[model samples]
Target: MSNLYERSLNVIPPVAARATKLGVVKGEGSYLITEDGKKVLDFASGVAVCNIGHNNKAVVEAATKQIQQLIHGGHNVVYYETYVKLAEKLVELTGGDTMVYFSNSGAEANEGAIKLAKYVSKRQGIISFKGSFHGRTLGTTSITASNSAYRKNYEGLLPSVYFAEYANCFRCPYKQKKESCSMECVEQFDDIFKRIIDPYSVAAIIMEPIQGEGGYIVPPKEFMKAIREICDKYGIYLIFDEVQTGFGRTGKMFAHENFDVKPDIMTCAKAIASGFPLSAVIGKKEIMKNWPAGAHGGTFGGNPVSCAASLATIEQLENGAIENGVESGAYLKKRLFELKEKYPIIGDVRGIGLMLAMEFVGENNVPNGRAVKNIINYSVEHGLILLNCGTYKNVLRFIAPTTVSKSEIDEALGIIEEAIVKEC
Candidate 1:
């Protein structure tokens, strides 16, 4: 029989391409058991979905129990224990003043979030950052500006959408340095509202707390606060696309907590349900309540098994997983900084908690995507899996499981360093 990758070539389209071709039969903790029987250290974490680690015992048990009880009860038709319970848990976690709407994927949740904003606010304009990736749906594609390729040939997207520069201090869009920064990222809205679209016309402003596909760019606390203020001033809803930064990936339950700022709306997925397909559009009660019965609906939005998995996943995160992520993230970041000092190719290292990244650059700080490509290939060949991000694909992100141990991080770091030494 042909291997999985070989068999896939005839059936799967290139659009479903993956970072690696290694087909795995099973996963345990931080490692994947490949069909060829090699144990590959998984730092990709299924692109931050298997956050609590692959096949976590509690998650497995919860999902198994739920499956035995119920498989699918359409959210639009009926209520279930796991689904309602998970929403209550999320409400409690998010300050008891918010409500959640379930969906199947990050893109779906984002689509719902924007719809909620537009429905409640009765506005048509939406503002998104230039380097943000909301989702792939046509509705979300209108608000996503991370790459032109995502929008290629799919023009005439949702209109009344505007763009703003994200706060990337490293490569400031306005060319301002950290020391001399005038918060142009925030002030740009003035021009946007004046030149692009009226603030009053904007229903929502969607952004990733930490730009995922664009690069692991973390905006400053002041920037977040200012954005909140802007939304408050204009009576426009603020939406955080936390698909890649929610759960325990950012040390905190959500990345917004790091800035001490709250958004009117938030979208979550990826790590929400261990490896289960689950996503949520979490909005303040005031806003969510305004979005009545028929505003949004989905058949498999709140899968009983998925909700059970999410609850177990949240329980794991609450117990000690987040703390481990904090400690391990700090260690990994410090080690990465050391690597940066030792290698000129490492132009920058940034990100919070386990969502860290290293941007490779060549002569005069030019993006070195080739170097990143080579390093990822070399690392995989040597029994480690990694992923790349950024519009230029020069940024290598580390999405290690929050439950990762010091020894596991050390091992991954060793592999990374070896790859750097060999490829860079």
Candidate 2:
């Protein structure tokens, strides 16, 4: 038998997972075909990047046409139609009058947003929540305090960030009785701001409208409205990091829309280009005022190819993709809820739209890590690629394509049910 996995040398810094066998050969709609000719149902959607689904003809054709015409341009010095179109679409969807800065990834977009917040406010501190996963880059890493494993080795410079517990709702951070809790998390932030970070010193308060990697934690509409009021009262810029929740992952185009609140600045990347690497920091015009000609620039910031793909993706979303996302996401969540009722291991199955997750907790409501891991591993082996996240690594996050079919969801759920039953 020919070994699909073979050699390893030195040059490449290996990832913690399986090494020497970590290549993906090709991707079709909702599946990836590996080099060894294995078809893997991609539920993770490349970490929630492929919103429109894989091999989408519109995205591919747009990218191909751009590549055939122009490959590179100093984007800062040029006024390309594709880039301008993208900015226009973003503004229209956000329902905010703002400027935009293009970047290579969500982290870069967030970094730009951070700089803009400080530049506009001249404030030093940034307030972020615990159990948040921003990105691996230095600036974003500073705001993120998710896992110690990701934070252990890297030392040098994370500073001036304050943390307040967000509305976990399911798992109360204060250990307060669930019945008596009245969004005390928001009240806790009042104390955090007064004692730890002076409102004047806080440039921005950044958070995911719906916590993505912290196990799809969805807060109540009132919580968001309350925060908006706090930011308004304090003149602190509210930065919504919609890197995972934007572009129809949530039932609304932007999760913040679900609430009657809006952010002063928003950063997005995943699902922005429908599998292409493109991110943007969009903010109110006043906040974006200090942007000099060259303050932020990347070699591939808005490469025509990616921009074209993004424009096409955005157009499709505006037309009907997002509408379908709402319907399909509702269906997926409902089906998962049905499964949860049948299975006691599913502690909480909650989400909005296609952004969904199941937190596994025992009968006593403590996190069940082994059961969650078994379900994930078994589902992957059974043709459905499952993902895990949470402070305890016990939440099963489902981020398949927004275009995922009901039939596919049914099949995946069946496999998950069997796995949980067998494992438990």
Candidate 3:
């Protein structure tokens, strides 16, 4: 029989990019069992979607049970047990002041979020950050600025979308030093409002709490707090694209919690359902209430099985995976920093919790995409799977499962170090 990768070539399109061509057969914890009988350490975690680890028994069991009970009750028509229960749990988790609108993917959730903001606030303009990846949908494509390739063929997108700078302190977009930095990332919005689009016309200001695809860039708390204040000042909906940073990936239930700031609207997916195709637009109840019925409706927005899996995923996160991520993330960061000290090509190592990254650069601190490609190739050859980020494709991101063991982490790190030494 032909391998999955080879079989895909005959039918699958090239639009969906794969970081590795491994023919994965099974997943257990932090390891992927390949069709060729290779047990590869999975640090990518399906782009941080398998937070509680792949094929988790609890999640699988819950989904299976729900599948038998009610696979698709049709959210637009009627509510099911799992669907209502999951929403209740999320509302409780978000302090009981928020309501959720279910969708099929991160892109759909973002579309709903923007629509929610525009509907409730009755505004036309949207402010997004440069080097941010919201989603692939046309409406979201308009706001995404991580790479031009994403919006290459699809120009003349949703209008009134403006881009601003994200605070990547290591490679500050404003090029300001940490010691003397004056929160220019925050002030850039004022310039945008003054010269670009009027803040009053802006419906929402969306951002990744920890810029994911633009590289795992974590901004300072002050910057997030300032953005919160700006949104409050102008009645703009503050939207946090927590699709990548949610579900214990950031050491907290949500990345925004780390900065002690909450968004008026939040788009979540990825780990929300532990690999299930589910996403949600969580918003303040006050705003969500005003979003009249028929304003948004999807046939399979909150599938019963996906909702069941999400509830189980949440239980796993609360049980211990989140705490494990906190401890393991610190351990991983320390090791990566040590690697940075040893290798000159490793320019910057930064991230929060399990969502960490190391930017590869040349002698003069110029982005070295070639080094990243080589290192990733070497890592895959050595049984360690990894992913790359940054618009320049020079950042190596680590999306190891939250439940990863110290030994598994050590093994992946050793492979990475060996790859850097031999390849870069």
Give the clashing pairs for model 2. none
State how far residue 234 of model 1 sits from its true place (Å): 0.8
Model 3 residue runs over 4 Å out of place are none
Candidate 3, 108-223: lDDT as tens digits? 99999999999999999999999999999999999999999999989999999999999988888778997799889988888998998888999999999999999889989999
- Writing each residue's lDDT as its tens digit, candidate 2 over 114-225 gives 8888877888889998888788888888888777766666766467888878888888888876568777888987788667877888999999998887878988787889
TM-score for each candidate, following the candidate numbering? 0.99, 0.95, 0.98
User: What RMSD does each model have against the real structure?
Assistant: 1.1, 2.1, 1.1
Query: Model 3: which ten-residue window has the lowest total lDDT?
Result: 1-10
User: Residue 313 of model 2: what lDDT?
Assistant: 83
Tell me how far candidate 3 lies from the true structure as C-alpha RMSD in angstroms: 1.1
TM-score computed on alpha carbons, candidate 1: 0.99
Deviation of model 3 at 236, angstroms: 0.6
The clash count of every prediction, one per candidate, is 0, 0, 0
Cα lDDT for residue 259, candidate 3: 96
